[model samples]
Target: MERLTIDDMKSIELEIMDEIDRVCQAHGVQYFLGYGSLLGAVRHGGFIPWDDDMGIIMMRDQYELLMANFNEWRTTERFKLVSYRDKSSIYQFAKIVDTTTVIFENFVGKKAATGVWVDVFPLEHFSEQQGPALLKQHQRTGLLRSFAVADPSVGTNAFVKLVKRIVCPFVKNKDLYELAERLDRIALRMNAADSASTLVIDVLGEGKLEKMFSKDLLEPIRIPFEDREYFAPSGFEEYLSIQYGDWRTPPAENARPVHVMEAYRL
Candidate 1:
């Protein structure tokens, strides 16, 4: 079996993203290329030379509709949708995975099953006035996101793995998602149009910049990516600034993003 190189993985992810674009467009579901994916569109017009991951953000109702009618919208046999609702999933967000390939990841002392995929996230909202509470919530979200992974052998080092084995075992798999659902209830708002600002997945972002923007910039705009146009946040300049300050400038070689994962044909 031949290993899937970075280029190979990128090709798969792009195809999956394109499918997502098609499905959302056909159904009139609005979404925005998010996090590093959005940054790539704004800065590079494609994958950021070193980044392999893809992510998109949708408003509350839009995501619910897509998930509810996922099967009907999914036109390709190569893709399968999974979310925290699934027993094997650790993420609170949804993913559209390429069924014919697999990806094995080990990073920052964690390991889990993923695949050639594009991440789908809801546009989360909170009251800007509640600064202390929002900070604490994000800290909790990042912690729970890790715990949701539920991998017993979750570390690259012996000491970390030993500690994780002791901790991750205590939480029952079903209980993890239950906790996530509880956090979902804590969401103060969901509709982007009504929100003062919007945030995507915190743990999955590049920097801890703010997603808050005046509602005007919340509308979607078309931008070039991979020689094609895709929808990005209308306040994209501010959006990118929130995710990555000075995002227009490319990072130095050593500072560029890197993913410690491998993909292969299954």
Candidate 2:
């Protein structure tokens, strides 16, 4: 089989997004292009030239609805939705994967399976006090994730790395699955639907809080992405500003995607 090029990857990603969009529309679940995917939509009207993957986010309630209905709604012949709830999944977030294609990233370590995939992040509610609480929860999640992956380098510091290295030998895959469940429970316990702000937990990294958006700001609005339209927060400008100051300005060439990936149709 021939290796997939950048365009091939983009084509598969777009197909996944279309599937997601269809399911969301059918069920009234709102979603938005997130992180680099959102930046690409706004700044370039499509995928960033150097980007290889896609990310989309939904609020917690809507996310739950999707999870409840995903198996029935998904393009099962072509795609599979994997979440932390799945024993085979290690990541905290969910993924919509194209089974016919494979793409691998170096940072994720060993591969249980390979496929073209888009990340599905859930935006959880948070109050001011919840920051510290969420921080603690994420710290625990980070430690468990490190052990689960058996990667000491996941932590930013030497001490945490040392601890991970020491403990990983004793950790098993089942323990990792349990940790993921705990992390999910923590997120649910801390959800602040009555609060004015929300955050996407564990999307950027463990314990890294996303920008807080007011409830009104989160109301969905249509935005042009590629040749189609998709939902984004009404306060997209504010959200983008907080996440990337002067998001309009292109970064230096050398600062672009540093890692390269290979994808292939199976």
Candidate 3:
């Protein structure tokens, strides 16, 4: 198996994204570049110089429709979709993964390393009337999500590692997973009308509140990414501002976060 360079990783991600575009187009599913992918499209013409991978998100109904028929819409045998529904999946969201290659992430144990994939996030509604109450619920999901991948290897510093070790014993992985299932059920039961003003994903790891965006951004606008055009949030300027305070300025070399990935053909 050949080891892959960052360029090779990006190429695989682009291939997956292209397939996603085809499927979404065929199903009339509206998705927009999300998280870093969105930031990259607006800040750089394509991916950030050091960035790899891509993300696309859709509203709950649109997401369901896309995934329900994704297998039939896909033209390639090399890529497949995996979601929380899969027993082996640790994430609550879906991923379009390349079966041909694998990648090791710094934050997880070696056994958790997975095939190169693009994250497919599902956007859920947040109510205006129950804003404070809903936010606390969202925060709990972040806490559980953090613990799902917790270990000494999670952080670069020894002090942080020690802290994780202290908390590791009391938290059982299966119990947390069961809690997640319950929360997902709660979300399903309390499902609100799609008219909420704010939208958020399930896992808001670090910046909990800052990760949310306005519902007004739901309307799609085409933007340039790599060599082709892709959909972006209509109110991207406002959407990005809510996510990153000064997104236009690139991070300093010394301050830039390290992204560790080791890829190889399977």
Q: What stretches of model 3 exceed 4 Å from their correct place?
A: 172-207
- In TM-score terms, candidate 2 sits at 0.84
Best-to-worst ranking by TM-score: 3, 2, 1
Give the worst 10-residue stretch by lDDT in candidate 1.
Answer: 200-209
**lDDT against the true structure, each candidate:** 0.69, 0.72, 0.72
Range of the 10 consecutive residues with the lowest summed lDDT in candidate 3? 200-209
**Candidate 2 RMSD to the real structure:** 3.5
What is the per-residue lDDT of model 3 for residues 1-266, given as tens digits with 9 covering 90 to 100?
89998889988898999898887888798999987899998888888878878888777778778768787788987888875555435555668889898888876656456689998876666544554465577567656656556655567788878877776556535454455454554344323633444665433222254566767777898899989888888988887777778888998999876677789988
Q: Report the lDDT of model 1 for residue 144.
A: 61
Ranking under lDDT, best-scoring first?
A: 2, 3, 1
Alpha carbon lDDT at 44, candidate 1: 82
Error of 2 at 68 (Å): 1.2
Alpha carbon lDDT of residue 232, candidate 1? 87
TM-score of each: 0.81, 0.84, 0.87
> After aligning candidate 1 to the native by TM-score, how far in Å is the CA of 172 from where it should be?
7.9
